[model samples]
Target: MDNETTTTYRKIIHIDMDAFYASVEQRDNPELRGKPLVVGGPPEGRGGVVATASYEARKFGIRSAMPSKKALQLCPHALFVRPRFAVYKEVSQKIREIFSRYTDLIEPLSLDEAYLDVTDDKLNVGSAIEIAKQIKQAIKDELQLTASAGVSVNKFVAKIASDINKPDGLKFIGPSAIEAFMEQLPVEKFHGVGKVTADKMKKMGLHTGADLKKLTQDELTGRFGKVGKFYYQIVRGVDERAVQPHRETKSMGAEDTFAYDLTTVEEMNDELDKIAQAVYNRLLKYNLKGRTITLKIKYHDFRQITRNQSFPFPVGDLETIGNTAKQLLLASGIDDKRIRLLGISLSNFGEAAVKVKGDEVSEQLKLF
Candidate 1:
């Protein structure tokens, strides 16, 4: 093919490892291979929610982040293991090293997921699908782990296609095949559209991707605000968002719904402390020193609200975390109400060492 003709097609790949942490444990200990293994905390106490589960556990409707008691109720024979972040991170680095051989345009969504743009690769790969197959096989053979990959002309299609088939699955979507591929795609599957958006779309008579396309841009924009433009383009299978690396940091946080609404200051404080630790851990890992601390609270009636305060200096200390959270709690002045959820987030991150997107403007936007 002519060079100009070749330049018309962009090659993008999204690779996600299959049940990463749980799979790693199973791979290292063959005895755990066929069992329904869950990785997280113990299956007894309040903090025991599964972080990852083997595919066998999934068949029993046991899923990640589900309560350990609930998972055991679903799969009584399931095996539970503690989370090993160090091991998973090591495997992730190894996987990224493998991708560097094909393209340096890599944007990691998480330790187990990433987007790769190979349009200007030095490897001179002729076929995107062939490259995806090779990457998957390499992961399996070298790491003794399974991975699913999607190859497409852009990031959006590649991400969605990657999940079409799971655990050693590979799918491709070319420019000519975009229309057929999107015809039956659910609104819930659209990029950036979550369960809340899906419900809103359903109420607006939009069910499938085709149905979403019928709405005027203004209509979708009115419904979705700023992200409507993305929805419109996705419905038409036209996402211009490049898979460039080094996108900046915008916001980070953690939230949790309680099994029962908490009515006391002590109970709320306990939950807030846990959330703060989670936020701080992530901040330390990413080397993010944030100046703002936010607290989110939800009442028994589902009336949710948030409060935030900016500090003079970037903070990552537990004392600052607790105090900022307490200040927010006092500011909300909802002590009489039964709190159903608590969340803590550190934002206003300063300069970071890594970039996730190539465009400086996009990096400033801090979009994922």
Candidate 2:
């Protein structure tokens, strides 16, 4: 299609809350205001991983998925609270209602973020940027919260633009500006370019989109396979993927890479208990249960194995997740092994809703 025809066909907006879980906690509890706050599990003893770190905590080098033990070391005075996914889900639904005022094509990425297509808005508003401003204001006025919005003609540019400014920021990358915006963006900042891929690109003198654009699709695919093909199109601002509102959540899981390895079974079980609790909370939040419980173990040498047991009936309770994982660990024989990571997940949503099936292992991505 022609460029003008393409521009009018899609106009996507990505709305991301500022440290969502932590922000909600701070908003509800005034005592947490202006202090470093982490919402996940307790930060004491064997501890847990951070689900979300407040901007204040982030200043101290604390981040989501980091060990709660390490978060305490970075900011000992930081406040730690277990996540209340139920409350966060409530807030998510409220924000979504606000989004419905502008568009029905809304795809939620998490409880904290969503992608909205406002190309043909319900309100008949022609300006995507204005619609974004209105949505952000509605969130602030109605929910007493702030969010960042990125407006562009497609999902990729809009997702990246939303992060340009954060914690109450809005950026619009129009059709003309997309080229310059992508060219200067750091390779690491590209959505799918993980650290491993970025390191390889840097070693090959490709640090920015401009540097990446020098390679042909065949050359890129030769270097990075499937992901390389993605890079070739993304660098040219050619992401045509539609805003899929009903993206299936194939699996729900929580994993942590620790500061130290567990040399004994006791230590490993403690970590597993924390991870199971996290997984259980997420299950409740999504209102999902699965028949499969997978226990993931990574050793100090980076070797990993997953052992999952399926049940006739789906389970999402805390006890089942924790106890089953511990049992699997025991059967696997963990004697004298140095364990560096532990995670638990529920998969095979098993008729929860909408028939979504998928599995994913996520890497830490920076939020603006």
Candidate 3:
């Protein structure tokens, strides 16, 4: 490579808090510590699910987004509590503050995970590993929480490295070592490979990065569609995306997986109404309004469909959410299909989050 065209490797870090919401609840309430605790809606409530669970609860297979009723069946003595978004957001802010002390290139994937570009450390820390160590220490000392950090030359490798060691684990993959690292990774562990895709890849005799490398880019693309191009490069330890700071939330919405299937329009409508209200409330909280509304329905047999409509202007009202979702569901012609899940979301954010009403809501209530 010419001098001007040589690759300039960047030091990137991905940090993920360990069971964040459940940890916060455990920290604030001493009585909940060292026990199987779940943070989310009560199991008896309609559409209840586990938002997150402590490591203790996870021992019994409790997990984030799992149905709380199933979680109860898995661990009968598990304590389930409603989520306190305000508290969790506060902790998230504190975590971001700590990151800012090291680098401004911070992209939050959620309240619990973030990616930081520390190619030039603000603290003048010579090593990215040291910077990660300081960040993990700060969270432990200040917030009484643990975070896993993954460090590497690029975002893709760094993200995978971070999960290698969980619940306060740190791993680093250097540029020279990344290729060997990628070759050993399972197909399911790649960024875009879900369970279904992994199964398909297995059937194709591609179970590892090495197996995938045997296929040419054209062949992979032919088999996996557009994402195959990504796999072709990533299996070679190449990902050129930067760590963007202002990664905006493209869409915001609420969804629910019902405890029982709904076969009637009345039951489905009632459920959609609740979901619309939840979506509307979130829009207000985020100070976001969108021109498009999307409805998602999952049938009892696991078939799913999504329908969307765009208005000429932005909408952030309860009526619009409920009516638009109901219309879409009806238009979908569910007929006698039993629905197991329903969701409503707003998108096409051409505006910023703002105060929708004249009354001043507390800053503590602000969530995005």
Candidate 4:
């Protein structure tokens, strides 16, 4: 098939649950409805982050990944609650069932968001926009929750359109409108362009898609590395990536940036205990075991390094993960270095595992 014909006939939709964790909390509890809600660790703790915030809390500048303390400072009255991943996962399964009724081609980015290719839908819904509407309505009717959807020719545009009108919204960006739509989008809004990259782009006077389009492909690649090629095509509303329903989980890991650098071995080990437990929980959730354990460390000056050990047999126990990570840390010679960030990851699972897309820029860039 020709490129235009190939692009024109494709139907992709991106569905994102609005403030998923916070919304689920509000849905289950009448008191949290309409009130600003923060789902994550409580503000009373020293090192807790916000997992998600209700729309009402978002109005006060609270966002996912912000410190719970900062979220509280933004809106002192906002209620904080811990995340119930098991409950959220159960709800996510029901959401996936809803999507399966329309199309089997589903790419779940997380528990709360996914992409569906309805080019050949099971229900014979010829219109992508109509399918998106039906899916949104079904989620509302069946689950007592709201979802926003974006329908377009490809994944990139569809994902961005999904966010234009959030919390129960549907937007369809047709093939003809894709060019103009992409050109006007802010650089920061582009996927894979994080705060650091966006700041760099703005300082270079590249503030919007139009500004980015002005640069040659070589210029972009030279300035931004390999991902610059992605920027070049995406700025013109071109994304050819197919939605892979069975994207392999090459690795699973978690990392944390500290509020203050750790200057002692005891302090660093304490942080590793927390991080390793998190990794263990995730491994258990996916029923995955890995043969490799990697420890990543970032110094106070931002110099980062990784140390990993591979075993003949796969392991997932919390004790093994924690001890291995701590051993890796001490073996790295941290006599005089102050550390600001630490991470633990497991990889080389003997078989395929489901991948949960992470918020890290490095991980997001790998999708392209």
The per-prediction tally of clashing pairs is 7, 1, 1, 0
Those runs of model 3 whose alpha carbons end farther than 4 Å from true positions after fitting are: 1-7, 41-47, 256-287, 296-308, 317-342, 350-368
RMSD of each: 5.5, 5.3, 5.2, 5.1
lDDT by residue (tens digit), candidate 3, 236-256:
999999987765556778777
The sequence of per-residue lDDT tens digits that candidate 1 reaches over residues 126-184 is 77788888899899899999899988988999999999999889998889889777868
Question: Of 1 and 3, which scores higher on lDDT?
Answer: 3
lDDT of 4 by residue, 74-94 (tens): 999999887786788789889
- TM-score of each predicted structure versus truth: 0.78, 0.78, 0.81, 0.82
Worst 10 residues of 3 by lDDT: 359-368
Q: Tell me, by lDDT, which candidate is best.
A: 4
Candidate 1 vs candidate 4: which has greater TM-score? 4
Model 3 accuracy (lDDT, Cα):
0.85
Candidate 4 TM-score, true structure as reference = 0.82
What's the C-alpha lDDT at position 158 in model 2? 93
**Model 2 whole-model lDDT (C-alpha atoms):** 0.84
Predicted model with the maximum TM-score: 4
TM-score of 3: 0.81
Ranking of models by lDDT? 4, 3, 2, 1
Residue 12 in model 3: lDDT? 97
